[model samples]
Target: MSTPYEVEHGVTAGQTGRRPQNRRVDMESFFSFLHQISTDAISSVSSETTPQTHNNRHAEATPVDTANLFRLLQDQFATLRQTSPDATNRDFLEALIQEVDRDIADLPRLHGVGQEFLDGLDRVSKKEILKGKKGEEKCPICAVKFNEDPHPLVVALPCHTSHCFDLECVAPWLQSKGTCPMCRKNFVRKKEEKKELKEDSEEEEEFDNMNGVWLATGYPQTVIAIRGVDEKGLALVRNGVEVL
Candidate 1:
C-alpha cells in the first residue's frame, strides 16, 4: 500500500517531507514545490493519455491536466492545513482546498483563461488600492482584508474599475471560470471577440492590398452588383456590358 503522496509521485513521502517545521518557506521554494506537484500531475495525465496523443499527433497537446492538477493542489493544501500552526494560514489553506475541490467538480463546464490573459491582467499597486479608502478593503473571492498581508498582489479585471481581487485568490478562479467572480463578467468571450476582430482585420487588409490599389487606379470605379466578375475580380458595368 502506498501513501497518497507516494501514489501521486513515485518517490516516497519521507524524501519530500523533510522540511523542518520551524524553518520559513521562501517564496521561490514554495512556488517551486507547487510547480513540481503540478508537473507530476501533468506527467501522470500524459502517461494515461499517451495512446490518444499517439493516434493524433496533429492535435494540440493539453497544457495541464486540470482535473488531476487541481486534485493534487487540493491534497497539498489540505496537508498544509493539517500541519499549519497559525489559524489564519489554516483558514486560508482550507479556503484554497475548497476552491480546488469546486474546480474539480465543475470540470465539465469550465472554460478557463489561458496564461496569456492571466499575464496581461492589470496589476493594482498597494498605493492605488489604498488611495481614498478609509476602511479595510477585502478581496471579493477569499474575503480576506487587503491590508492583512503587508504586500498583497492585487489585479484589476477589465469588467470595471471597482472589480479588483487578490491575485493569489482570484488566479485559480479566473483559470477555472474565466469570469469576474463578483460580477460574472466573462473574460473568455472578450478574448475570443478580440481574436475574431483581429482575424477579420487581417483578412480585410489582405483583400485591400491585393485589389484596392489596382481597382482604384485601373477602372472607372463604378461599383455595382453584377452576376459576372472581371479578371481583376471586380463587379463593374462598363458601357451597358458587365466587364469580365
Candidate 2:
C-alpha cells in the first residue's frame, strides 16, 4: 500500500522505491519558488508606481520660493533683452513687466498704524473730559476745542505729555503718519528698528538709499505692494527716507 506522502507526491510505493527525502526536498523547493514569485510581483508593482524624477516629487510636495522665482525670472528677462531684441521678445518682456506691475498694485499696502496700535489708543468721551474740567484743551490736528467739536469722539495718545486729539481728526493722521502732532514724537518705530531688535538684540541706525529705492525685507512673504514697489521696483519708505 502506498503511504499518504508518497500518494500526494504522485509516486507510488511500488514505483522505483518511493524516496521520502526527494518528496521533502520538492516540497521545500515549491514553497521557495512561490515566495520568489510573490517578491518579484511586489517589486514590479512598486517600480511601476514610483515617480521617475525625485525633483518632480519634491516640487509637487514643496511650496515655491517666490522671491527666488522672481529673481530667476528677472535674470531670464535680462538675458532675453541682451540676446534677442526682436518684436516677439520685446512683446513678451513688456507683457511680463505689465503682469508684475498688476501684481504689485494688487498687494495690500502696509498701514502706518497697525490695528493693535490703533486699538491701544485711549478712547475718551468728550462729556467725561468736560465733567473732569479738562475739555477746554484744543486738538492739535484740527485746532478745534474738544468740548466745542461737533463729534464727541476723542482719543488720548500714550506719549509722556498725554497729548489727545479728536478721533475724527486723529484717525486719518494716525492711519498715514503714526506720530504725536503736538510733539512730533513717533508713535510707531521704524520697521528696521523692530526687525533689528527682534534678530540681534541691538538697535541699529537706519540708512536710506540714494536713488529712492527700497526693498520690503521686513515683510515675511514677498507680495509687491504700491509703497513697496514703484516703477523702480521693491522698496520701502521709512521716515521720509527710501530704504533698499
Candidate 3:
C-alpha cells in the first residue's frame, strides 16, 4: 500500500531515486576541481635561460613574454576604454593557454583578435592527427570498424595506446579500481557503497517504524548492486536483496 508520493519523495528508496536538483551541487564540485587542475597544467608560464646577455637577461621569447603580448593585446582592446586604466594589472598576468581551440575568424573581417593563434593550433593538431589516420581498429562493444576514429566502447589509457577497454565495462571496473591493474592507477567506488548507505538508512527508518511492527524495504537495491558477487556472499545477506 505504498503511495506513489512516498516513492517519489525517496521515503522508500533514498539514493537511486534522487533527482538532478539533488545531485547538481555535488556534480559541480567534482567538475570544478577537474577544471582547476586541467587549466593550471595547460596555462603554466616558464622562464628560459637567455642564450646571449646571460648577465642582463631580457624576456624576449619566454613563455610570458609580457612586452610582446602586451603590445599585441593593446591593439586588440583599443576600442575598450577600461583597458588603459588597468594596464598595470596586465603586466603580471600572462596569456591564458587553451586546449583544442576550433574557432577561426574570417580574414575579410579586417581585424586581429588573436583567435588566429588558436585556429593555427587547431590546424596543426588536425594535420598531425590526419597524419596518424592510417590504421583501423575495431570497437570492443559493437564490433564496429573505425579508422582514425575513437572506438565508442574503448577507453584509451593516457600513457599508452595498447591499454584500451570497453568504456562502459571499464567505468564500473574503475569505480572500484582503487588502482589500475596494469599501471596501478588508484580509483575507488564500491558500487555497493551507496547501497550500504541506503540499507543503513532503511534500517534506521525501520527502527523508527514504531507501530509495534515494521515492514522490510525489501530494498532489492543493495542486492542488485552486488548481483555479480559470489554465492557465499549472498547466502547470509539475502534479506536486504531486492528479489526483483
**For this target, which candidate reaches the highest TM-score against the unseen true structure?**
1
- The best candidate by lDDT is 1
Tens-digit lDDT track of model 1 for 167-208: 655655565557786677889998889999999999897665
The TM-score values for the models, in the order shown, are 0.50, 0.32, 0.19
Off by over 4 Å in 1: 1-64, 70-110, 211-244
Cα lDDT, model 1, residue 230: 48
Whole-model lDDT, model 3: 0.28
Better-scoring candidate (TM-score), 2 or 3: 2
Q: After superposition, how far is residue 75 of candidate 1 from its true place, in Å?
A: 7.2
lDDT of 2 by residue, 163-204 (tens): 776553454334333556456467667545676677654322
Q: In order, what lDDT does every prediction score?
A: 0.53, 0.43, 0.28
Lowest-scoring 10 consecutive residues by lDDT in candidate 1?
38-47
User: When superposed on Cα atoms, how far off is each prediction in RMSD?
Assistant: 11.4, 35.6, 26.2
Candidate 1 local lDDT, residue 158: 91
